[model samples]
Target: MELVCIECGKARRPENLFPMSCECGGLLEVRHDFRRADAEKLRALFDSRLALRTGPYASGVWRYKELIDPEVEEAHIVTRGEGNTGLYDCAPAARYAGVRKVWLKAQGENPSGSFKDNGMTVAVSRGAAAGFRTLACASTGNTASSLAMYAAWAGLRCLVLVPPGGVADGKLAQTIAYGAEVYGIEGGYDIGVRLLNRYGEELGFYVCNSFNPFRIEGQKSIVIEAAHQLGWSLPDWIVLPGGALSNASALGKGLLEMKAIGLIDRVPRIAVVQAEGASPFHRMIASGGGELVPEPEPRTAASAIRIGNPPSWRKAARVLRECNGVTCAVSDGEIMAAKRVIDRSGIGCEPAAAAGLAGLKMLAEGGTIGRDETALVVLTGHLLKDADAIRMPVPGPALEPLAPDELLARLASVR
Candidate 1:
């Protein structure tokens, strides 16, 4: 497999590579050949090995071997078995939205407690194999934690650059646990990403962020797992929240590959759910500019969606346009409401996860999504990873238990 330049579509190897879009400027990305034979064999394999917990199959993601990539050895996949997430056949939610079939891709169940693991597994492994001792990336929350975990397993030094606005405490805890160098940049994730890209080039550090092609290869497995679980039927729509916008592109690649081998007939319409704070991609879709422009002052409680400047905005724009997709921006209050309902459904998705649900609700209410559309909204991360992050109107400290009357008297006095 070879990486392709997004600009020239020129193919190249990934090891110790640099962006050609430099002095001799051009947009580019590492591309992998999607053509593969015996693709239908995976369906038969799943039927035969559905309940086997022996050997590598026990690892949730590893069950689909051909989908994910690992550099050193296939066994050392750097996976906590991140894929094979539970899909809920939600009748109530479906009925509410008036969709034919509504399914939930609960990505919160991943190893890192977030969907970022899908990329980290491949990125960190390839980074280690490429002799990059130190790996770095700019993140909102989940990516930092996910990279930290994988880097620790790969025995590589990890650095996380975060902005003040996002970067949830739970995610930061993982970075600290890996003994990584954490820097809080005063600016947004884009500032950190640009600086890291420059520093990584000069300092010979590995940028294991979404820009790395290996990450997309790893994330593509989500769609693979989804299709297999669905008995090879593709959904009419797959709604997801776009931060840097890598996931949508990766998923499109997966579905397209499956389609090539006759695993499915069509790729689903991709819907990007974004926060009102910063919605440049949404604005692009509306205007059909397909160009990137930075957001001045993004404001929203869905901190993960608060990317003022997305690095992969161009590719993301292309994906939206090509897939006949639409981007919807939801407010913070609506996000919280969606979170509560998602929690009640036993999904336990974090705020970032709820962003998609909020968008689905909005789209349905506005009659943008037809009743005939069968939608699958991805619940992108685990709320348990950041327990209190979503709770609105936070209550005071927990009350202490006191002995019968004495405790009651103290409480009464305080009141």
Candidate 2:
């Protein structure tokens, strides 16, 4: 595998250092030579691994190890059985989105309760293999929880930089509970990301953010595994929330690889949804596509996606262009409405995870996504990851009398 600069096209070997960008300040991507890979054999191998419930083969990300990182040995690999999330066909969600068929892949079902683990497993494993004693990242929540969990298991020091009061309480608790050394940045996730990008190497740590090419490799499994669950059929569209935009970038890479390897016949259109308050990516697309202008002060209740200066925007932009993807921003109210719909369907997700469904509704109304097209919404985080976002009932008496008259009154109001 070689690390190729996305902009300058400069290719180099993967080193032990942590500088993620190219000399021209562009992001890098991992490229593997798969010219000799037998597509039929790979399909059979991936399918056969599904019956294994132990070790690296059991991990959804590693089950396709030939595609993710063939160089990483089994002994150096780190996994918590991540990426085995379920894909659900929810009638209520489909009805709300005005689509004939829709599926919600609950990525929040991962060990860390978010999609980050899918990438973290490969990244941390690579770091460990390279003899890095410490791993670090700047995260709003999910990445911190995932990195901390993996680093702890791998016997490496874990450090996390998070915005002060920016992360959800449940996510914060997970990071701290996992024993990561946490620091608070005053300006929020954007500033923290900037600092980490510039000084992570100087801090003597191995940074494992979406900027890492290996991390993006593991994230490719989200789409690949979805296709496997769909019986190797590509969907008409794949809609997902955009935060760091790494998921979007990874999906594009995964789709291209699958098509190249004869795993699928067509590519799925990607739809990226962002919270209106923190939507630099959507704005970039709205302006007919150009360099990203970072949001100076991104504000959103969906803390997971409250990023003003996303690091992977360039990679994501390339994906959007290649995949014929569309972008839209949704208000917090719309997000909450969609969340309610998902919750009512018994497939609960965090506020940020609902942005896909909300965006799908808008896309359907605007005729961008057809009423009959099949789409899959990727839910990135579990509902409990941001429990504070859930509204509680008004304070009332602890208990009510079990009288027949009271029961009859409640019953009358129910319908």
Candidate 3:
């Protein structure tokens, strides 16, 4: 497998794959030799396992392994059977907002309870194949837990760097329980990023950041699976809570590949959703340049989405203009409200998950989506992953029924 520089169109072998862009500093995208005929030929690889009526992995994502080059071809995927998560048609959540057919891509079903499992499956799969003894990432929380969980499954050493006071106990517990070396950094996520990057280079550790092309390769299959789930039909739009921008960008690449293979006729407009407190890409959309505007100090309950400087900024911008898709930011209050709102609808999710739902609601109100349009809103991780970050109005423990003469009666009844 090889990649071509998107800038100079120069091809290089995978062995010489540079994790970041070259002298021009352009974000790299993989180039495949699979032309028209190969696209149609791609699905046959998983013909025996294809289950078209259900989730896409039952058909496309897992089927498109030819397009993705894993480092260890012979190594079994380190999935706790992560992919093929059930998609739900959220009737109650949709009815209140005049939404027609809102489907939730609940990635929370993954082993560590998040979509990070998808990328980790590929990361751990490749790391094992490539003979790497160590794997690491700098994360807000979920990615670290995912990396650690999958590394443990693959029997590889896992190193995690996270922001101090930014992570929730549930998240920290998950990572530590997986036996990863958890380092709580005094700085922010981006600072942790630089530290991890330099650390990877010095220690020869395989990085699991947004900058890693293979990690994105694992993400692309999400689009493939989504398409297959809809019986090879593409949705009108895919909404996601954007932080690193790799997820949306990779989804786009996956859709285009499917179209190249004639599996889908069109690409969905990929809308990137962000929390208003740290909407850096929203600023880029307003400024009319791919260059990210300086991000403001963040404040939001959606701590995982508090990314001021996303590394995949430029490519994310290209996707925005290319598809004419727009970026939308939702207020922290609305995100919190939506968290309650979704829970009321029996779909409990974190604030970042709520942010995506809020963004979708905003788009629907603004006529960005037609009432009949099919939409897939991704809830990236589980609410349990960061339950502590959400602010409740009042602290209350579980209550038993109050007696008529409560204080005295309860004292007698308590015994």
Reference-based lDDT, each prediction: 0.75, 0.92, 0.73
What TM-score, to 2 decimals, does candidate 1 have?
0.89
Clashing residue pairs found in predicted model 3: 72-129
Per-candidate alpha-carbon RMSD to the true structure:
3.7, 2.0, 4.3
Clashes of 3: 1
Q: Could you give candidate 3's per-residue lDDT for residues 1-415 as a string of tens digits?
A: 5765666766676555445455565556666665644544555655555644543234233455665553335435555656676677887656644577777777776778877777777767766666778888988888899899888888899988888888778888999999999888766778777776656756878888777666777787666766656777766788888887878777777777677767787778888889888888887786776568747466567887887778777767767766667889999887877677666766677778777778878888889877777678888888787787566664465254566687677678768
Taking all chains together, each candidate's TM-score versus the true structure is: 0.89, 0.96, 0.88
Candidate 2 shows a clash count of 0
Best by TM-score: 2
lDDT by residue for model 2 (1-415), tens: 8899999998888763457888898888999898888888998999999999999999999999999999888999989999989999889999999999889999999999999999999999999988889898999999999999999888899999998889999999999999999999888777777777788888778889888899999999999999999888977999999999999999899998998888888999999999999999999999986888989889899999999988899988889888999999999999999999998899899999999999999999999999989899999999999999998555556255568888888789888
- Candidate 2 regions exceeding 4 Å error are 393-415
Candidate 3, residue 110: how far the Cα is off, in Å: 1.2
Supply candidate 1's per-residue lDDT for 56: 51
Error of 3 at 172 (Å): 1.2
Cα error, candidate 1, residue 282 (Å): 0.4
